[model samples]
Target: MKRPNFIVIMTDQQRWDHLGCYGNPVLRTPNIDAIAAAGQRLDRFYVANPICQPNRACLATGQLSTVNGCRQNGIPLSPGQVTYAEVLRAAGWRTALIGKAHFQNVTDVPAPSRQAAGKGDDLPASVALARREQRDGPDYLNEVRAAWAANPDRTVPLPYYGFEYLRLCIGHGDQVEGHYSRWLRDRCPEAVDLRGPDHALDDPAVRVAQCWQTALPEDCYPTAYVAEEAEAYLRSCRADEPFLLVLSFPDPHHPFTPPGRYWDLYDPAEVELPASFGDAVNRRNDLPDALRQAYRMGDEDPHSYWPFHLFEPELRRIIALNYGAITMVDDAVGRVMRTLSEVGLDDDTVVCFTSDHGDYMGDHGTVLKMGLHYQSVIRVPFLWRDTAQRRQPGVSRVQASAIDFAPTILQRAGLRVPVGMQGEDIFAAPPDRPVLIEDPGIGVFRDPDSRSALISLVHDDWRLSLLEGCMDWGELYDLGADPNETTNLWFDPEVAGRKTELLLRLAERQLALRDLSLCPTARA
Candidate 1:
């Protein structure tokens, strides 16, 4: 049998429940649903971290964010770290990443400085900035829009984080820049001016927060650009040589702007509120102090990147617009899949669909994602269609993590899973292991004294989260009972022993996940 090709389709900030196959009643994702029907759907797939860069890095390296060192959104996947793509590429497999290869920081701005308390080690600000810039490769800023704006001719250097050919979509929504931006400019220069809320088609009826109807035609959108590029790449592939093509869509994220006809595809008035939306019980009993305060007083900076509470009207419109974006992506997927079949590669290709992470999508009245361990944010849709007959085709209730992605792909391609990769081959068998999710430095907001980091453990039927700086305030949800995660059983006397056992399990899992990528051959 021929070594199977790989096609990974990933979406940004999409919840597991937002797809047609995943129990979403309203959203029309027939293309994605078809994939699920034809193959295996991972019902309980979770991300290693509930952030874009960190979880994506985890998928690339098959290592946790803690091990790979991409612990947050701004942090880039270090060039030195080995990616599964790099391994496959080295082993005579072609690798290409199209659309939103966010392996590096998308913005030119640096993260908050954390200096050690030592007067002698302090350096001048300019020198410090220069040194920081030199930390990553010279092409580190390839994804930054400002850098691209300054140099229009700039393109991602070959073999970026293991992908040989690249077509990057930097930033989100209609306001994206990078290769897609260049393509859009070439196709329709006027479409560029039509992006953003400032020039959005007036939709006074829509009351979604940070949502607008983009005037850019659906064909000119980033989703279309990704599908077109992917189809072209598929047509360019050699039948004999195996290849890994990753199609990452940057849509269905913040500042919702589905273009053209997709804008009016769903009516906000008809959209129903999430079951847990504005639940007074969870707000009062389950929320940590910071979140409780935010829920009560409302977010001061609603437009900021951090997760915030949203009103019912705003959430309804947001959900409708988000569905529009998702539907557009689904259409794009259908286009690419048709191209794959047309090119006669469908039978030989191992196709997988998932997301880097998920958005709150109005779960618990929240609009975005962050440190929260809510199912809406951490759990994502994962569908695998292995036409090679390597894996069984059925809905799997087995819990899988993003870390398993690389290993699964490698194993399916008949490649050796490299040393130091912490992920198991998901297709091999059901892994009866607790999924460990680590989010560092996600503290309680507005509370100056509280500096929290989140570490969660998801086992059979329970999800446990330990917030480091919020005193004894932790979250324990019985997922079997309450899938919406409305009730907190952390301090409950009845589940006290269970909580202790789960905590012990979390500690054991952490210990088990320790870095073993490299083993010492010689004793010092």
Candidate 2:
């Protein structure tokens, strides 16, 4: 028997509801929908963190953020930590990561090198004066002001992860030029132009336009081209030797910029607003204002009231655009799947589809991913297709996490799960164990005073949430009754004993797993 080839397709900042199979009416993700139809779709799939780098690190190492020390986006995975790539490479499986890995560099910069140089010193003061000029107008002057205020010393080196084949963007999409800026400028000097008026650099659409004009066939837009390269690799592989391919797409993340055709794919009027769209729930309870402001969700001041409810129309438009981008990626998935079939490797390959985390997608008055644990951000779509004879193909509604994926992939490849992996072999185990999820107590942006941490134990009929740190709110939901989690039953004295029982179970499991970082505060 030959080892099954693994192809894991991960999209950035994508929500589960963006797929057609997940009951979304406007979005047409035919390829992913087909995968769900042919394979097993786990109904309750979640990520340990709602952010990018931490979740990606968890998926790669099969460990939680605290254990791997990749608790934030900018933090790098430790050099000593063993990754699935290292394990597979040692076992003779060819490994390749094509697209956004979000891996961080670990080099230390010297103090002298950090000091200011060139005319860059005057840039910030000039930009601040310009911002003050535009503060009373339609344009957002602060964006321009901040760009000028940025230090010229911040330089991120490449190949943060141990991938044999890699193509990645260091930070946000617009910042791609900064890392690849010199290379692109050198290659296409006439085509590339970064020197425009002060306002042009701040406009996301303008920056994207600059990138498209200067990019080559391979780098023109690495995300789409990488998919093509991965498909070719899949077509050329042999069945005797195993391989692990990570197809990470950076689309649907930011700038809301897609190819022209994709932008036209969906009608804005046809898109439906979310059920919790534009609701003024307690923003401080879930996420900080600074993080929300970073994604342009709210105002600057922590307590300043922003008209989030008024943005529903534009927010729905953004969601519709994001869905269009997802559909574009799905089309790429279809191309890859068809290539596998054409090369006669379809039945010999194990296909897994998921995301690093999920986008807010206008849920709870937020547009992108930053904070909050609503199903919109933490719950991602997980589907696995087992072509191996020993595996089953039926769908399971059991709760699963991203950490379970690495072990499952190793198990399918007949490789051993490392000793320190925090997740179990979800495929080998029975569907009866409760699924657990955790959120660290701090907000990435704004509202620093409203720190909160949550640990949830989910079973078939009930979900018990133990919250600590900032807010003393605990929630118990009958998932059978409140699938949307609209009602909280933690205050009900009648269910107090049941809450305590579930909390005990949660505590016991946390202790057994040695998840000490999630331990409750003294008050909790």
Candidates in order, TM-scores: namely: 0.93, 0.76
Model 2 clash pairs are 288-446, 289-446, 290-446, 291-445
> What do the candidate models score in CA lDDT, each in turn?
0.83, 0.63
lDDT of 1 by residue, 1-524 (tens): 67889999999989889999988889999999988888999898999998888899999999999889887776688888899999999988999999888888888775555544346877777665433543455657788986765555676678888889999888888888888877887898787578887788876565455777788888999899999999999999988999999999998888789988888799989887788997645345556754454344336566656767777777887899899999999999999999999998888888899999898888877778774689988899999988756556788878889999999888877888999999988867465679999886444233323455788999988999987767578889999999889888988999999999998999899998999977899995
Model 1, stretches more than 4 Å misplaced? 118-134, 203-207, 281-298, 388-391, 441-450
Model 2 C-alpha lDDT versus the unseen true structure: 0.63
Which candidate has the highest TM-score of all?
A: 1
RMSD of each: 2.9, 10.5
Counting clashing residue pairs in each candidate, in order, gives 2, 4
- The local distance difference test score of model 1 is 0.83
Candidate 1, poorest ten consecutive residues by summed lDDT? 441-450
lDDT of 2 by residue, 88-204 (tens): 777888788766666543112211111233564445544434223311222211112123224222332322344555544333332343223434355445423332222222344
Candidate 2 Cα outliers beyond 4 Å, as residue runs: 105-162, 171-219, 283-297, 301-310, 388-393, 441-452, 515-524
Error of 2 at 181 (Å): 6.8
